[model samples]
Target chain A: MYRYDEHDQRMLDERVRQYRGQTERFLRGELSEAEFRALRLRNGLYVQRLAPMLRIAIPYGMLASRQLRQLAHIARHFDKGYAHFTTRQNVQFNWPRLEEVPDILAELASVQMHSIQTSGNCIRNTTADQFSGVAPDEVEDARPYCELIRQWSTFHPEFNYLPRKFKIAVCGSVADRAVVRVHDIGLVIVRDAGGATGFEVIVGGGLGRTPMIGTTIREFLPAPELLGYLEAILRVYNQFGRRDHLFKSRIKILVKALGADEFRARVEREWETTRRTVPPLTAAQIERARSYFTAPPYEDIDAAACAGALAAARATSRAFDRWLQRNVGAHRVPGYAIVTLSLKRTGIAPGDVTDRQLELVADLADAYSFGEVRVTHEQNLVLADVPQPRLFELWEAVRAAGLATPNIGMLTDIICCPGGDLCSLANAKSIPVAEAIQRRFDDLDYLHDLGDIDLNISGCMNACGHHHVAQIGILGVDKKGEEFYQISLGGNQGTDAALGTILGPSFAQEDMPEVIGRILDLYVAERHGDESFLETYRRIGIEPFRKAVYGASH
Target chain B: MALLIRHGDIVADDWVRLDAEFDTAAPLPPGKLLVPLCLWNARRAELVARDQPVGIWLASSEHPEAIVDALEDIALVAIDFPVFSDGRGYSYARVLRDTWGFAGELRAIGDVQRDQIFLMKRCGFDSFQIRADRDPTDALAGLEEFSLVYQSATVDPLPPLLQREVRRGA
Candidate 1:
């Protein structure tokens, strides 16, 4: 993890003081409610139904063990003993007083973290793949670039008050784990014919009321020119993106209205003038940033120990065997395995990690791994660089701590947002819906049999949960304050991106789990031996699932 | 009454602004003319040399390096704020005064706000065109919003750490 320098530390300290003053003024009634709303949101403070919620940024989902311990401390003292990890790789506390938010921020700043730009219509936290540096197929680390973008976008003058919120994701691997295609700006790190690594830039992709796959505006933009090209795109969007309707204010709508060719032409014209004129990225600057992300020191260990781990998996515990098969991945170095801590325990909330659990994760990271942990966009935790010999022992500790569950890609695994229960914008409560689905499918073997099905839910039209990209998506709508659920199928978040089709009209809350059960049943009947649920659905289409769900007589 | 310049407005100020209708080969005017930030391209370089100006009013949207080559010749470089909240002009003003060795009077025009006056002044902007509707007195208060800023600017080249140490010693 990158350590904060003196300058970085001072900036965060000053920001905390600034926010403290702002919060005091708001509480004193000197600032109007409307005025305070924007300011508080910029600091990631939200007035929820039960209490105020504070969201802390986990930039690019990277965390040092010390930072994790700080987060755990905050949860223990300030919040309700728990924090929910979000789809954007952020963590949110469901309860905090407005008066104490400054104290929370003060604690966060001590660890080089703050909640700036976590909310409001600003450039948000830039996200990337969880297995960024360690993945064997990765072209480059991609974290240093994410950090650079983070610094550039933080408190940016022209872009601070954009028409709507903007999201950017970078992917360095071939598998697209970051879901790059569904971001406002997606940069896929690629190597050119001459073997120089740069970016293939995609623009205007997002999911809200209107979901879109970003179009490639520039191919093979040299690494040095990345900032300049990004400036051009943001300049164009800020100048022309609509501000009249909040729902239609995203850059995607502007790209759609202008047509891709005209948008591309405008951006090109802007880039042609600015590319040479903007400040050139110096080699020294890149090196300074890259030094923070150099590979960790490793000792060459015996490959024979991995075979012992496999034997341990097969000997006693069927659960451990399943977990080792699904959640464990190969490391670039021998004798090490990347361990994904599954948050999807059946009948519990998807990404909610309690304060005690946070401390446990931190301790585990410090003891077993390289003192580093990563939060995934799928809302799970990762302990990278764990040695193979310690896998069984680590599994025992994690299971006892309630961190080990062998449902990494199973049906019980869900990606969800704090919908109507916490968000003022949501129309229905998403937690209960996620819980109901989990409870109905509590059988781990059944979920494993179903295999690799993505289930996502959003509380409202904003789609903050990324429900639009799930293989099985659930959207909550309100009819006169009565919660109703809507289901969509065949959506995907992989390289070949496709939006799901709506199955039919909305269903009552009680029917949701049954509808999902029928859909799973259809998949089980129609699928070939090795086909994943998405593949089965893609081949057979939504008609079979629709028939099983709504056809009746089943 | 304050006159607002739209996208296609023609101006008679000393600095001539070049737009889509601009002719590159035209002879030099008698005095300086304000030019749009985009006029620094190769096609307009010949015309720029012929009409060496007292200053140019650069748009905030313009790239800073566009006008860097003419820094030696230009006298008073005026940059537009475009909107009160827009901040690109602050960085441009900083680069012009500090990095490019521009010693001319730096003026800020259009959408200038009272809240932004202090930051603008710290970034090397000395002159301001207060918007007609807003009270200049109120706009001046913008320069006093914060008792101190942590980060260094063109006015205070020392970063926060050094400044804090100096203050402690004092």
Candidate 2:
């Protein structure tokens, strides 16, 4: 809900013009393919297998209704009437022509949106929890800090061409919903012992071929000094990060090579000077940013009326009861609840919303909640302010529109990436494998009985699907030019983040669904009263699951 | 011949670059020469005896802080971009210009092209050695690629929100 100011608007408009000029120059042969590739990638345009895929930045995953409409308009007019939400809380359109990308950017800018750093070796779109402001357990609203970072990193001169892409995640809550442990930099807002809120800055976390949990570099960085500390860290990485090999170039590699203690020392040395020269964020400036994210007006509701209506609805409709249990989350506001419009409907790709669905969601936001929508890293859409009284009606309408599957945080909810079907970097196709698993688990009752499970699949080790942090992680691999999958178990993404351990050899694509089924069956047989898959896996270890999937001893 | 672009115009250069084993080549007499970090660090006392203004050439892998003490004596500092994507030189230039207070000319050499002129200039590179194949004048337009910059640079060092202040005190 941060509206663009005059300066912000002008920058985006100028960026569109700049990109148009760059596109023209490239087309006219003033720029070679290799030279233009870096430039185009910086603008979030990737030359995929089919066509150019443009990843648009949904900064901190917040989108206004007007921006959503513009996205729908672009998809209808320029793309194939759909957009795929990414695991990084961004959106990707699959079929934009290379030449019309500037036009697409211009369209996005009209609604104060642009895909500036969605890709490339720069500080990418800073992501935060989707329920940033509305979550009851949150210590502070993270949107303002996210907005500040977005402004600072936009076209940053010093860090425009980093050694590798950098990702930063902000969390203001006790629960790690934003997957902070797997980002290059994770800032958890925390109050100091003296009660002044600052950030616990975690550095060097990443997921790819090598997944690393971030190391806490600073226990408590004063709130105003956040940007200064970040500059110092980037300065160190920009100078020391490996450039010899692409895979070894992430900040995580540098942190590992030099050791976290040495890396922190270097950053602190640089910060000693940077903190003095650069002005820390001022109270007035932070207040100005906070002003943009204040709560919307709400009418006081009668708790008795809401409870009576909810109980009545639950008694009458089992479907309503199921939907309420899975899709609704507690809101900070007394009479309100946060709703997730499931984009993981069966028979379709996870995290994908059609143009009509996008428009319909915008309409629903205007009707039930505020005219604001948030895209989650799980690839779901969030209606963050639906009133408790209106929950049942909204659920019915959304479910009828095919926007609801009642699978938020359920087993059927999957996080997947566009694999070998479209991605040039993928070693195997992931969509078919995801579809196979979703079809096998189509029984709603069975899925619910399975309890909270995080299922994620990545076409390759790029980890865009975030398979490394899932309870059941599937990574696509190539063997003798044949597509196969290697599964991992017991990974987690919450406060205690851990990478999954691989089970035995890779499985054939045809055998993947059965392999998953065997793993689930093993879990059910071994589980004790309400033990989640993660808990059971932790207790029983991977031996049982591995034996079940790959068969017993020789 | 390397065409040196200084102060936004193509200028004649007089600095001679000394390669490795120069000390063993002969009893070398130093003049307006740009020496590598190892040569300077190893033979500073003898090299500093030269009465002429000296310069240093920093490779992408070298840290600028290694010669912070000698930065005052150095008349020019040149940073190389091994590849356009290798951005170590930008941070090197920023460290020299913004943090270390190296006031002499900071030049970008090797693999730098017309399209990178804007970024090079923003990062405090006042002199450029454009790649041999491209026309330097055409690449000069890169310096004017955009009229506005969102974040401050060495050339434009005012924080966006604090521009009204008379001076930003350290």
Against the true structure, whose lDDT is highest? Answer: 2
Task: List the global CA lDDT of all models.
Answer: 0.78, 0.88
lDDT of 1 at A186: 96
Q: What TM-score would candidate 1 get against the native? A: 0.82
Per-model TM-score on C-alpha atoms: 0.82, 0.96
* Model 2 Cα lDDT, one tens digit per residue, B57-78: 8888888888899987889888
Candidate 2, residues A1-554, lDDT tens digits: the string is 78876667887887788788888989999889998998899989999998999999999999988888999999999999999999998999999999999988989998998889888999999999999999999999999999889987888888988989999999999998999989999999999888898999999899999899999999999999988899899999999999889999999999999999999999999898678655688887677778788888876987678988999999999888888889898989788999998888888899888898999999999998889999999999999999899998898889988987888887678899999999999999998998999999998899889989999999999988899999999999999899999999988998999999998889999999999999999999999999999999999999988778767781
Task: Return the top candidate by TM-score.
Answer: 2
* Cα RMSD, each candidate: 7.6, 3.0
For candidate 1, give the lDDT of residue A55. Answer: 84
Candidate 1's displacement at residue B117, Å, is 6.3
